[model samples]
Target: MSDRRAIPPHSPPSPCVNICVMHKTRDLCVGCFRSLDEIASWGSMAPAAQREIIDQLPARRQSLKRR
Candidate 1:
């Protein structure tokens, strides 16, 4: 087996469900909740970067909930 355990698997498809809208102020998506730049570059970014962004989502949602 390879020694690449630190990397995550390929990104999963967007669960868009046709609800494509971005958060105007934060440049995040109200639907998928990813930042616009993140969404745009999703296909090319490496798994580590993707995981870093994915890791922020829950906190973002919590911030939104507080507002």
Candidate 2:
């Protein structure tokens, strides 16, 4: 039997829900709640930066709900 351990994901999964529309006034993706710059930079961003953005998603979604 081989001793194997599950490997963790290399990077944070994207926030894209494939609903790729941008909010006109808010300047955030209505689905993922990320700004255009954030979206564009996602692939190049470090894991920590990615996590920071992910951490903000809930609050961003909540704020959108208030609109």
Q: Please tell me which predicted candidate would have the highest lDDT against the true structure.
A: 2
Per-residue accuracy of model 1 over 1-67 as CA lDDT, tens digit each: 8776665577756534466787667777777678777888988988778778778878887776676
Query: For each candidate, what TM-score against the reference?
Result: 0.69, 0.83
**Model 2 regions more than 4 Å off:** 1-9
**Quality of model 1 by C-alpha lDDT:** 0.73
lDDT of 2 by residue, 21-61 (tens): 98888999999999999999999898889999999999999
Instruction: Name the best candidate (by TM-score).
Output: 2
Query: Each model's C-alpha lDDT?
Result: 0.73, 0.92
> How high a TM-score does candidate 1 get?
0.69
Model 1: CA > 4 A from native: 1-9, 12-17
